[model samples]
Target: MPTPSAEAVLADSAGDAAFATTLAKGLVVLEAFEGAKLLGNMELSVRTGLPRPTVARLTHTLAELGYLTYDPRVAKYAVGARALRMLHPLLAGMPFRQLARPLMQDLAYSVRGTVSIGLLDGSSMVYVETARSGDVGPHTPDIGMPIPVVRTAMGRAAASMLPEAEAARLERQLEAADGAMWSGYRDLYRDGLRQCAERQFCTCFGDYMPAIHAIAAPLFRLRDRCFAINCGIPAFRLQQGQLEHEIGPRVRALAESIRVLVARPESAEPGSRGAKTQTR
Candidate 1:
């Protein structure tokens, strides 16, 4: 079955008269560029399940509003500076990213791996911040990259932080959407969640991608946002059991440190309580 367009889905599900279907459709067109540099109307239509003509009109409106730019040379649209500017506010709202940066960088160097922060994005876990040891590779997560919610250690650890009912609801949604994907990782997902519950961290070995191993722990927050930290090192870099014995505990501690820093009152300014916390 074809995925319905944003307009159709919203129309059916939304009872509120205040809902702006056209505005949503246009935003959906923009979201079609999630992992792409540029896209044409047809591509946007296919990606968003919106009609081509509708996509064309939406793209034109967005371009007019400075949210998108059109390159006549290739006849494609790219997200504009305005759209990038819009993201700045959202990024600014995450007060923890700044506090976690140095700590994550230190941990990445300590383990010869990459340390990243993951936040729930629908059914995916998106990296909102990252620090890494050396040259980047395909497996090294970058900010804005997303991984499966049930398929990576970071995702599993984050999911484990969810309330039981919320987690079960999400599980049902994912299973209903893609039974094959959910089934393939269901048991492993549960195992990872159990590990997080028991040890406050979970490890993924050669999952999410071949030859990539990672450990993650959730950063429990009072606010609604759920975040996790993942430290990923190539499988070859480890001998055996290093993920659990070394990396897991370090990641868990790092997460707790960050949680405290972010949760501190505004009056408790950095370095005011005492010396700055050192990651080393």
Candidate 2:
């Protein structure tokens, strides 16, 4: 099924007395720009399922609040300065990211893959730190990108490390929230979990995209938060059994190394990238 809109995903939340629906609706308008950098009210209304008038009002408020910027010449809106305000503080504060970067970069260079650290967010995994060979350019995933919890080795690996009760609850929630996605990938995802249990890591071949093949392992709970590390390479570059036999173990070892470092966070200069974690 097509990914549900933010409105559809939050439909049940609207009924809560303290939900602040107006605030949520406004954020939904901003979220309509996910893969899209610019959109007008009609497009925003279509993406969000909000009426055009409501979209207009929310967009106006968002623009006023600096969460969005309006382009009169092109008649569109894009994410604005206020969003970066939150990003700056977040990218500057995480101590684990400082601890993880050198290792992630080392793996990225050695494996010629994009290596990323992702943190759980609601039911998804969002990239916290992403290191790529210089040649990969912008074609690969970046920090702040969100991938589904059950559809990725990164997400499933993280889930596998959770307490049994928490893992089962989140699995049920994901299946219910996105049944089509869950139903399609249930078996493959289960295999990933088994891989995690048997070998401390998971492999995903073409699950992310036809071009991307990846393996992942979780850092489990580190300093009260959970994170996963992933190494993804283009399918064209993947040798036979590379993801399963080679990269998978490498990623698991990377996770273990970071887990040890995170267990004992120390005072150190933030790498040039600084705080590379996001709890949200």
Candidate 3:
């Protein structure tokens, strides 16, 4: 799902009599800091659609709480160390990452592409683990990076695992939020999902990024959690045919291996043949 706009987030809480608007606004301020190194009061006000004075108050409170750091000289705010600390538990305890890292590494090495595992988060696929061979190109994203659902191979693969009704709901939501961009690529996105349903994998050729191509497969784990793994290669390095026929199937195999390992970790060690072996 696309990240909710600050207005939308606040609107959701507006109808509730006891909702904490202050806390919500403070969080929206923190979210505005995403992908940004520093934000001044005016920028935060513009992003959050809050008054500059309100933003200043929230920023000051957040700084005091260790969620944000204020640079007095520049009069800007940045994410604080406490926010990084808050993410440690989520990253450190993911069993899926522990089981999938070695397999992702091997796939990256074999295909000479960056490999990643992502989980559906709201309207985006958030990377949980990523691996890359020593290939010199194709910027590998850091963990926690969010990729839009309707524009990327991994996101499509993960979405394919959803029920038809849920998938349709998500598509409608995306179309509503991303109008022209979603309309332009809607056909390709549908085709990729159909391909994923047919072959258990999906391929994208420069759909999200102009010079990037990827093939991905969905993985299902315990408690109905779903994830996806993909191999991303630079367009110059891999042809469309290779992405569809070779890398696509290889990624599917890796995804299935991960599903098995996650389902029964006691039955397969991380680097053991049972976990690493491609089922076909």
Candidate 4:
């Protein structure tokens, strides 16, 4: 458990009013994403300490307005495109992709795989950028393609960035999913949190895409929100025992560099090549 500061304890004891609780908890559920990771309702329940039914109602309203997405395939939730639209004006003044590209390229080269940056959109992970060693594999997910939050490495790592209570609320979103999807959701949350606490990244094999092996790490903001970067390749082609041995450290390093760049906004110049154009 996190050791709460005196201020935090007092603030909780202040007890917000009913309408405040609804708005506060609703926004808290949305804040669960770091980049690509989506928090399901059950998971949201766990993270936010909000009731499962309350989360369901909140997410339902958000989804109806396209602020969050509900994916039946993975039975998870992600940020909606409309949410991204809201961030556009602020992101426009920043060179987010430029700051990320060099590190992503280095990670892809080191891992001999494809590397990508993703953002959370209501219940889906929107691929913002990518760098591949080459596209020789049978399956290569493209930029703008949305992946289910519960099934992908990027999604879990991103979700790990949320506050513990908020993370719990997002978990509540998972309770409504089908059995197979719920099982995967549970494993990803367990493993993703464990791996993130141990280091900066997590690894997965054939979870998101069959035959694809991947490693992902988080990019943190001053506000404590997290984003994600991932490196992946066809599992069949990787050298024996290379997955964790070589890829993990390299990806972690690249992720750290990106974190540094994000931390120092002055260096994030838009003129840099391979930079992502801010999305609206």
Model 2, stretches more than 4 Å misplaced?
Answer: 1-10, 137-139, 222-224, 264-280
lDDT of 2 by residue, 1-280 (tens): 1234456556978567877788878877877787898999999999888899999999998999899999999999999988978876766766788889999999999978799988776567888898988665334888888888777888877666655555666777788768999999988887877777677788888886777888888665544455778888888888999889988888877877886676633223211111222122
Candidate 1 structure quality by residue, lDDT tens digits, 1-280: 0133354456566777888888888878876787899999988988888789988999999999899999999999999889878767878888779888999999988878899998776567879899999853458787777788888998888777666566777687668657898999999988988888778789998778777889998765335566778999988888788889988999988977886777632122211111122111
Best by TM-score: 3
- What are the lDDT scores of the predictions, listed in order? 0.77, 0.76, 0.76, 0.65
Cα lDDT of candidate 1 equals 0.77
Clashing pairs in 1: none
User: What's the residue-level lDDT of 170 in candidate 3?
Assistant: 74
Largest lDDT belongs to which candidate? 1
lDDT, model 4, position 134: 68
Q: Candidate 2 at residue 109, lDDT?
A: 93
Q: What lDDT is reached at residue 113 by model 4?
A: 75
Candidate 3 Cα lDDT to native: 0.76
Question: Any runs in candidate 3 off by more than 4 Å, and if so which?
Answer: 1-7, 136-138, 221-225, 264-280
Indicate the TM-score of model 3.
Answer: 0.87
Give the Cα error of residue 33 in candidate 2, in Å.
1.9
**Under the 3 Å rule for N, CA and C atoms, how many clashes does model 1 have?**
0
